[model samples]
Target: MKSRKRKIQAPVGRAAMLSLQINMLRDECCAVAAQLMKRKTLDEVELEDCARLDDALAEAYRILRHTVAKVTLARLRRKSRTRQQ
Candidate 1:
């Protein structure tokens, strides 16, 4: 007879997905920052590209930071509620 066991599932929550996207954006920002730093001064095209990347990175981090804070708060609340019972 074969034993039955359930397979472990990876996180599929919004926060989890956002965390992944945040990491991808972080890597992209590093690449863009390195490319920009290599040049003494940005040309018009490079300046525009750098500006867009900077804005994107800022927005990504804002959302990521908020999501992480919310998750942490929720976990703490759960723990406190259990302890109070």
Candidate 2:
């Protein structure tokens, strides 16, 4: 028996374009977090930390939903097809 590896293909068309945009957006998100952390006063830093974390978690959830929605949809479609058969 021979061992084999499967290769993953790069996304095409709208997916590729959207991936590029997402990459840029992710970088911007990092910059925003860094900026948020640069506040001076003790109170300001604590408030900024809390605010930044809340915003970051929300943003993460949104990004996860967007990307994972595609996977979930594909899985559902496959399951539907199986049921049809």
Candidate 3:
């Protein structure tokens, strides 16, 4: 029997990884929002539910800022390298 070679996949880039994180965070926020929306009236919603949604939104914002900083840093580095060359 002959052995077959398997193709290896390339590693994910930093930006792609960050993008996935952002998407997951968005899904989480949507889920929390949906839970709150299930109630017929605003009074029906619990404080914990509101807090949960707020926390999720804060986390999403943090991740977005971090992603922006990383991309900006990468761009700056690339520009500096090109200038030096």
Candidate 4:
């Protein structure tokens, strides 16, 4: 029997990039939320700490929303182009 090699291709396309960005932001949001929860449970959370986490979470969500919007627009543009052709 001969051994065969398999090739792995990197993700390519706007959708793939957007998916990667969304996954990263999701992970960041989850980590920040978990830290906030841990602090709350310990009753050591301060207003400043909460505010900082809130800002971080909000920013991540904002970026996620924008990335989704970009993906949607790209899909729509591609569809329209196909229709035009």
Candidate 5:
């Protein structure tokens, strides 16, 4: 028997781009973990490590989301002021 290969696709658009990146990151992480499980044996301890890494990735993503929001709001405010002139 042979295993099958799969391809992952990402979504498009500006506002949805962030979401796509996050989803891709998660999918890649899971793929890596799945491959590891197939090649090497992991105890519960290693599984916990993977979980921790996923949590950290999520936290970093949240910070990115906040930064994007702040920058976007600043740009909108600047544009609004220009229109008032």
Candidate 6:
């Protein structure tokens, strides 16, 4: 009998793929925030690339922080829920 498993190749290393995914997610978050600020005052708009980069960095941090928090919370909740059951 032949093996039925299919192997997938990564275009880049694991670290590189994680980095790129984080960067893309950060960019997407920043883009959404930027669009929300488009109708705001001049001071609310990102006028410099550095400022935009900063926002992206902050958003990335928030994403990571929230993801960790959520995972931890879910794990803890699962334990409690299982105990209750």
Best by TM-score: 5
* Candidate 6 similarity to native, TM-score: 0.38
lDDT value for candidate 5? 0.70
Lowest summed lDDT over 10 consecutive residues: which window, candidate 5?
7-16
Between candidates 2 and 3, the one scoring higher on lDDT is 3
Instruction: Please identify model 2 stretches exceeding 4 Å from their true place.
Output: 1-42
Candidate 2 lDDT over residue span 1-85, tens digit each: 9988887743434554565565566566566666656755345655566566657655765675577667767868988999999
Off by over 4 Å in 5: 1-22, 31-42
CA lDDT scores, all candidates in order: 0.73, 0.63, 0.67, 0.64, 0.70, 0.63
Model 3 Cα lDDT, one tens digit per residue, 49-72: 656766775677687667767777
TM-score per model over all chains? 0.55, 0.42, 0.46, 0.47, 0.57, 0.38
lDDT of 5 at 38: 81
In angstroms, how far off is 40's CA in candidate 6? 31
| lDDT tens digits by residue: candidate 4, 10-69 | 333654566567567656656666676677365345545655665775676577667767
Candidate 6's residue-wise lDDT over 1-85, tens digit each? 9989976643334434555577776677667667656865654444465466657776766666566666667768988999999
Q: In candidate 1, what are the lDDT values of residues 3-62, reduced to their tens digit? A: 999876434366667767766876776687678778888565765776687678678768
State the lDDT of candidate 5 residue by residue for 6-73, as single tens digits: 86532223534775587678677777677668865666666677677778778867776777677677
lDDT of model 2 at position 41: 38
After TM-score superposition, the amount by which residue 23's alpha carbon in candidate 1 deviates from its true location, in angstroms, is 10
Who is ahead in TM-score, 1 or 5?
A: 5
